[model samples]
Target chain A: MTLDALIQRLRDFADARDWNPDHTPKNLVMALAGETGELTALFQWLTPDQSRQAMGDPHLRERVLDEIADVLLYLTRLADVLGVDLLAAANAKIDRNELRFPARQA
Target chain B: MTLDALIQRLRDFADARDWNPDHTPKNLVMALAGETGELTALFQWLTPDQSRQAMGDPHLRERVLDEIADVLLYLTRLADVLGVDLLAAANAKIDRNELRFPARQA
Candidate 1:
């Protein structure tokens, strides 16, 4: 599904729960930060090799994927609240990054 | 720009820096986790209200947006290495979340 479609689903989900009042851009940003923390927590204390191999453990992988999903969902919602087009922003970021870290120069 | 386009740019960036060998899935995941931590650190002492108003402080907001971009770029790279379609996975996750947090019950 497209990012817009997912955003709409999130909107519907929030509307259904009367969560709109709480889903402001700021709140969503905060929530996104919290979720990011959770995602990071899963890999805490792991060596780089262990972190890379984390997904090899089925149970651990499931937990990690869930955290990843949470972070993305919150990000999508935050973008929606702020009227930011996540895809567009991401694309623009890449363009800037290309200039900053040019392949030929880097 | 599409997510695919951004992913391609990231791949190209890595190639330019000869960073491909260091960008393995495990390394990407670890990097992602680290970036998430940086994102979370920005909100560490803020109350909910402060967090929501974080972006009002121009410098803080810029920092926050940069962290957000960092988290996303790493995630996109990790998905590329793992052969995961981030959009598909996000959609699937919303489906599951709907079941788990049904509007009617939530």
Candidate 2:
């Protein structure tokens, strides 16, 4: 499915549950943190190499995938609630990063 | 820009900086947490109503916009590095939610 489709599905899922009231930007951001925390916990103490390698382990990979999806979902919902366009915001930041971290001369 | 274009830009940014070594899943997750922390701090003490209102404040709105971008960029990066398809993962989760939180009859 496309990104927009997935976001709409999230909105629909929440609507189905009568969860829009609870999906305020505040609650969405908090839920985002909770999901991010879970994602972080999975990689907390692994050495850099182990962390990358974890993706190859079926069980670890599933959990990591789940947390990442959760974080993305909540973040997407927060942006939707705030009427902020995430791709545009991210693209703007990328442009800013270009200026902030200018390419070095070869 | 499309999501894939933005992701390619992120990859190029890291490549230019020789930052692939630093973009390990563990480090990316930690960085993701740091950004989410900042986002959470913005809403920490605000009441739900106040939290929603903060988005109406120009300064708060800009910061909120920036933090959400950072969260998305890092998440997109993490997913890319892990070879996990975010749209697919989120789609899978939505499907699970359908079963887990089945819609109630009115």
Candidate 3:
């Protein structure tokens, strides 16, 4: 699905649960941090191969994806709430980086 | 120090170690995934407060920060190697998201 559609689904999910209030930019940042911790749970002790294979397991993969989606949704909302253009920010930072790490010498 | 300086340091670090060759975009992306796993290790089962406190511990925090730095450094190098502007990409993505989720009705 398109990123737009994915965001809408998250909005619908949050609305159904009345969790939007807790999704203020600041709160969402905190929640992202928390959920990131949860996502990390899946690979606590596994080797790299195990971690990638875990992603192949439907049950485990779904849970991990959900956690990641949770964080991404909150981030999207947070950016939306603050009137920040994530893509713009990313692009601008990237431009600056180009000058810092020029290609000719790299 | 400036972000540029930080990146220069990373370049120096990689060059001294002769790991620049392994920092191709693809490899850096993989390395990032790996370091992310390590960063996540510090707070596998900790409560939110505990996780925050863990960041305050010098040794543990250092390791976690190192892991995070490793990911960021690789990301920077990867972007450098690919000639991709991270900030530009971020900004561009953010702009697209703005149109996808407008604020007035949100």
- The candidate that achieves the highest lDDT relative to the unseen native structure: 2
lDDT string, candidate 1, B19-83, tens digits:
87787666776677677668678777887567667777889867767767777898888777656
Backbone clashes in model 1, listed as residue pairs: A52-B26
What's the DockQ for every one of the candidates? Answer: 0.38, 0.76, 0.06
Lowest-scoring 10 consecutive residues by lDDT in candidate 1 chain A? A81-90
TM-score of 3: 0.46
Give the interface RMSD of each candidate: 3.4, 1.3, 10.1
lDDT of 2 by residue, A1-106 (tens): 6678877888888887889889887898899999999999999889999998988899999999889889989998998888888899999998899889887645
True contacts kept of 1: 0.33
Tens-digit lDDT string for candidate 3 (A1-106): 3444545655665575566666554355455456555756655666644554565577875565455444445545544544444444434444555566565433
- What are the chain B TM-scores of all models? 0.94, 0.94, 0.73
B1-106 in candidate 3: lDDT tens per residue? 3435545666765675576666644445456456555645655666644553564567865554444444445555644554445444444444555566655533
TM-scores, each model vs. reference: 0.78, 0.96, 0.46
Query: What's the true lDDT of residue A13 in model 3?
Result: 54
* C-alpha lDDT values of all predictions: 0.74, 0.89, 0.53
lDDT of 1 at A62: 78
**What clash pairs does model 2 have?**
none
